[model samples]
Structures are given as C-alpha cells and as structure tokens.
Target: MQSKATTPTEYIHELPDDRKEVITKLRDTILSNLPEGFEETMNYGMLGYVVPHSKYPDGYHCDPKLPLPFINIASQKNHIGFYHMGIYSDPNLLEWFTTEYPKYVSGKLDMGKSCIRFKNMKKIPFELLGELASKMTAEQWIERYESVVKK
Candidate 1:
C-alpha cells in the first residue's frame, strides 16, 4: 500500500463508480470540516486524508510520513468502509460514536479498529462523522491509535 495522498480531487476520481458517489460525499464532508493541517491523498488503494508535514514534522506520534491518522473510504467486495482515524485514536470519540450512531442510523454500520463499515451510504451520518473528523490534532490522534493497537 502506498503511504502518500496525491490530491483530494484526484483521489476521488480514482474510485470505482459505485463507490465513487458515496466516497465523494464522504470526502466532501471531511474536506469541509478539516482541521488546519490536514491534507488529502491516496494510500492503501483508497482515498485518504492526513495531517500534513508542515503542521508537525513528525506527524501523529513522530512518524513524519506515516498514515497513522487517516480516513480511508474503501469499496470492498461486500461493502464500503469509512475508516475514521478518530475511532481508533480517541476513547471519548469512540464511545460517542457507538452510543449515538444507532440513534441516528437505521441501517448497518459495522466497526473494527476505527474502520466504520457500511454496505450502504444511506446509513452514515455524514455531518456528525465530519465533525468527529475535525476534532483532534494528528499527534493526539496517534496517541490514541497507538494505545489501542500497540496492546
């Protein structure tokens, strides 16, 4: 999997037709609410956004080029996954998501290590998801991701 994100627009252009529509809407929500230092790119064969090097030379845990805290919108054989770094990186955020998601959604939204999987985009709460995306700095996010994954 590649580690760098090319450009937000280009990333969307690369998605397959069925995935493109959902991911583009998801991408737009994220871009609209991005924190100061975030950037968009293509990594792991998916569209991703990260905290750029300018904000922190060593992004999110001192790994400058690592894709530690990113959102990966993927089109899998069975479903789509809206991977939010915040889900792995923040206890508070994760708790909130689990609690509130069901209240707002009527369909399936599966999760695993920050990856929010949904077979249909109709199930996602795009605005709430976007707000969560804008919540933390890459460094803080890395701390959360590492805390969970490193164990």
Candidate 2:
C-alpha cells in the first residue's frame, strides 16, 4: 500500500506492527550500503533513495520536479516490495541478481521489471539486497537513466 507519510521515519511508523520491523531493517540495509551522492527521501509514497537534484539537476524525466529515483522500499498489501532501477535498466545486473538469488533464498524469486516482492518476510535476503543497493552509484544511475531516456 502506498503511504501518505512525508518522511521515511514517518512511513515506517505508520506501518502495522508486523511490518514495521522488516521495513525498518530493509530501510537500514539500503541506507548502510548505498553509495555516496544518493539521498534518502520519500518518493512515490515509498521510502526512496534518490539522486538528488544537487547531483543531477535535470531530475527525473517523467517529472522534472522529482529527483532521480534509484531504489525504493515499501510495505505492500501482501508483501514487501524492493524496487531497484539499476536491475531494471541493466541486463547484466538483472542476470547477476537472478543467478545469485537462489543461493540466498529457498523460494523462487518473485519479481517484476523493477520490483522484487518478498512474500515471506523471514526469508528476505538483506545481505544480498545490500550488495545490489551498492552496485550502482548516483553518477552511474544518471548515466544509465540518460542512456535509456535519451534513446
């Protein structure tokens, strides 16, 4: 479910007790592993890690007012959703994550183009997710985003 909360802290606090811990952990994982130059903010009603306009003045093409979103974590209706733009934009990153997922979690990876759904909270691979978060820097994401958008 999309949160109406303004800040990440507020978003986590608004979640149900059952979801609060996991989402908090996921937020922490992303924050701890994310490379420099990315800022944490609420984007699209989720806890978003973005390339702020200070780093990329053009902002997101879809809406120039919003920052370049790199990653986002949200508490969904039935599952926790982790969205990573790098995995969606880069085939090699997608292949790497898909190949490595089975090694970390027992169940099949439930994923969309950019969103990874974790139905079972206990099995969420925080470590692997952290690695994925660290894979792309803000500069790299700006380059990748421009490549796809400018095409």
Candidate 3:
C-alpha cells in the first residue's frame, strides 16, 4: 500500500502492527549494509534509499528534480515489497540473486523485474537482502543506470 507518510519513521509508524517489525528490520538491514553514499528518504510513498543530489547532481533521469533511487521498501496489499534497481538493471546481479535465493528462502522466489515480494514475512531473508544491498555502491549504480538509460 502507498503510504502518505513524509518520513521513513512516519511511514513505519503508520504500518499495521503485524508489519511494523518486519518493515523495521528490513529497513534496518538495508540501512546497515547499503554503501555510504546512499541517503534514506521517503520516495514514491515508500521507504527509499537513494543516491542523493549531493552525490549525483544530475538526479533521476525520469525526474531530474528528484534524487536517483536505488532501493525502496514498502508494505504492499498482500506482500512486503523490496525493490532494488541494481538487480533489475544488471543481468549478472539478477542471475546471482536468483541463484542464491534458494539458499536462503525455501519457497520459490516471488519476484518481478525489480520488486521481490515476501508474502510470508517469516521467510524473508534479511541477511541476503543486506548482502544484495551491499553488492553495488552509489557510483556503480550511477554508472549502471547511465549505461542502461544511454543505451
């Protein structure tokens, strides 16, 4: 669900009690492992980890006024959604995540191009997600983003 909350803290506080802990842990996992250049903010009505304007002045290609988004977490209608741009844009990263997913999660991966859905919150692999978050840095993401967008 899209949250109207303006800040990450507010967003978490607005979630249903059942979801608060999972989202908090997910947010914590991402924050603890993400590279130094990414800044946390509320984006697209979700908790977002972005490469801020200070680090990449050009901002997002779709909307230069906003910072470049790298990752986002949200509580969807029926699942918790974790969106990672790196895994979506980079084929090798996608392959790696797909291959490694089974090691951490017993059930088949429920995923879209960039969004991974966790229906059974108990099965969410925070460590693997953290590792995924750590896989790419802001500079690498910018380079990857530019390459794909420029293509």
Estimate the Cα RMSD of every predicted model relative to the unseen true structure: 3.5, 0.8, 0.9
Predicted structure with the largest lDDT when compared to the true one? 3
In angstroms, the error of model 3 at 67 is: 0.5
In terms of TM-score, how similar is model 1 to the real structure? 0.77
lDDT by residue (1-151, candidate 3, tens digit) is 6789999999999989999999999999999999899999999999999999999999998888999999999999999999999998999999999999999989889999999999999999999999999999999999999998534
So what's the TM-score on candidate 3?
0.97
For model 3, what is the C-alpha lDDT against the true structure? 0.95
Better of 1 and 2 by TM-score: 2
Tens digit of per-residue lDDT, candidate 2, span 56-129: 98889889899999999999999999999999999999999999999999988999999999999999999999
**Steric clash pairs (candidate 2):** none
- Predictions in order: lDDT: 0.70, 0.93, 0.95
C-alpha TM-scores of all predictions: 0.77, 0.97, 0.97
lDDT for residue 26 in candidate 3, whole number 0-100: 96
Residue pairs with colliding backbones in model 1 are: 5-41, 5-42, 6-41
Per-structure clash totals for the candidates: 3, 0, 0
